[model samples]
Target: MSQKILMVDDEADLSKLVAHHLQKEGFEPLCVSNGSDALKALAKQPFSLVILDIMMPGEDGLQVCRKLRNKEETASIPILFLTAKDEESDKVVGLELGADDYVTKPFSPKELMARVKALLRRTERKESASSYAYRDLVMDVPRHEVSASENRVTLTAKEFALLEHLLKNKGKVLTRDHLLNTVWGYDYFGTTRTVDVHVRRLREKIPLLTDAIETVPSLGYKLVDEE
Candidate 1:
């Protein structure tokens, strides 16, 4: 089945243009003129991913993204922000708000399509993996569930992906850039700080991981056995 991509933008011309390109790329593109309609559409149906514009008539992209992340049913859907704002702060805020990627205005259609493919590919790859375990932490890929020390651990989608990567490479030191490229995909424009944030979250959720996940100053993180 063709993946459904929700394009939420107030610009009619741009939204139509993007939707055309998305269609050519083998995706079913659905467009919404405002954040309000975007939320309504999202609640009514499922989309493989969301292409959100930062500025809109009502609740804006950031607000919509925040609400999506806060809701369990829609939280895991990947969000890519399309905005005219290119400031570092804006990009960082979008990433922190659970946006998987960001594209500035006047972007090349080729690049945008490439990023869309990358994001979708990463999500599919993670979701298709078999269940894995590291000591007491078990990751159930099909259900997108995780448990540590026999207790359920609630993690955001990104956190779950990061933990799964660490578990797969236990005993190997993974640099921040490596983690960003591997877990977030190379199309992600954010810096390595995102890796640190997710790592901290994993440690907090699974206290046992605090001792197992080692911090190598000036390098990166390593999932190693506690000595």
Candidate 2:
């Protein structure tokens, strides 16, 4: 079966164009004009990915992205933001809000399609192991669940990916650029700061990791066994 992708954008012409491209790539596309309708569509069915526009009438893309990340049913679905704003800060905000990728307006169809495929590939990729643990913090890869000190921890999809990478390569110094390429994909448009933000979040969310993730001055981070 073709994977279903939800495209939420206020621009009617753009939606049609994107839908056409998605269909050509063997993806089933569903277009909606606003956040409310996007949410409604999501409630009715599961989608493999979401292409969201940042600017809209009400409950803009950021709001909608937040809502989706908060829901267990929709949290892991990849979200790619389509926006006219090319500002760095705008892109950062979208990523911080749990968007998997961002594409500025005036984008080429080739570039957009590449971004879509990258996200889908990342989401669909499977881990070799079922779980990873460090002290009291444990990540159940198959279940898409995490716990710190036996307490369930809520993490966005990106956060989970970032942490998994760190755990998989424990004791190795991983640079921010490497993390971005591995976890966020080489197609990611943002800066290394994106890696920093997500790493900070992981440390914050998993208290045991506070001192565990050693920050190598001017280098990157290394996950070491807590002494």
Candidate 3:
């Protein structure tokens, strides 16, 4: 069955163009002009992914993303922000808000499709083990759950994937490029700063990881294995 994708954008022409490409790629695209209607569509049916625009009439894309991330039912759904805001701060804020990917406006349809496919692929991929652990932190892969010192820790999809990769390669110095390719997909168009943002978030979310994840200046990060 074709995957269902929800697109939230005020631009009618752009929405139609995106829908056309998504259909050609064998995806069922549903376009909504505002965040309210977008939420309505999402509540009405399940979607494989969401393409959201930052600027809107009522609630903006960032607000919508926060609501989705807070809701248990929609928290796990992957979100890609498509907007005209190309500033580094904007990208960092979107990523911090639980958006799996960010694409600035004037984007190529092909690259957009690539990002869409990458997000879906990441969500659908399965790990061999049911869970992974490092110190007091435990990650239940299939269950999509994480805990530190017996306290539940919530993480966005990208954050979860980032931590998963780090735990899998504990003690190894993973380059930003390597982490980006492995966790964000090789087709990811973002820069290494994306890795730094996520790593900072992970540290903030899981206190146990604050000091555990060592930063190699001018290089990348490493999750101390302490084995």
Candidate 4:
């Protein structure tokens, strides 16, 4: 079945345009003009991803994001924020609150669609070998599950892929470019910060990797063996 996406934006024209494009891309897009309705719709339905506008009446995007993250049932759903505010702080705030991506205002429909596709692609469960493990951290590839010791660790699709790549490489430092190419695909137009965001999420989810994933100054990152 085609994935369903929820787009919450006060701009009726923009929502229409995005919904049209998403339809053409074989997705079912549901548009809500306010944060209240968006939350209501989310509660009623299961959406694969949410395209949220940062500025809205009543509960704004950041408020909505925080609520979503707090909800156990809705927390893992991916979110992409649409914002006219291009400030780095705005983007950082959204990312820190669990937004999967952000697109500035006046963005090309094509580019937005690309981001949508890449984000959704990450949600697909990867079917591969049995598992990949580094000590107590284990990723069951076919099952799309990750666990530290015996406790499960919840990771987004992007985080899962990033951790998998790091586990596969082990000790080698991977450049951000290489990680972006390998994990997000070559056509992904996002910056290296996207990699950093997912990596941070990974570390937060798997506390055992607090120091395992090292940041190389003036370079990229490496997943090292636990001493």
**What do the candidate models score in CA lDDT, each in turn?**
0.87, 0.88, 0.91, 0.86
Candidate 3, residues 1-227: lDDT per residue as tens digits?
A: 99999999999999999999999999999999999999999999999999999999999999999999888789879999999999989999998888889999899999999999988887774856568888898999988899999998888788888998898899999999999999988888888988988899899989889999999998899999776
Mark the regions of model 2 whose C-alpha exceeds 4 Å error after superposition.
none
Q: Worst ten-residue run, lDDT, model 3?
A: 121-130
Clashes of 3: 0
**lDDT for each residue of candidate 2 in 16-63, tens digit (9 for 90 to 100):** 999999999999999999999999999999999999999999999999
Q: Point to the candidate with the largest TM-score.
A: 3
lDDT of 2: 0.88
Worst 10 residues of 4 by lDDT: 121-130
* lDDT score, candidate 3, position 6: 98
Candidate 1, residue 55: how far the Cα is off, in Å: 1.7
Q: Residue 60 CA error for candidate 3 (Å)? A: 0.5
RMSD of each: 2.5, 1.6, 1.4, 2.0
Please rank every candidate by TM-score, starting with the best: 3, 2, 4, 1
Residue pairs with backbone overlap in model 4? none
Residue 225 lDDT in model 2? 61
TM-score of each: 0.87, 0.93, 0.95, 0.90
Candidate 4: list runs displaced more than 4 Å. none
> Which scores greater on TM-score, model 1 or model 4?
4
Once model 1 is optimally superposed onto the true structure by TM-score, how far is the C-alpha of residue 6 displaced, in angstroms?
0.3
Error of 2 at 76 (Å): 1.5
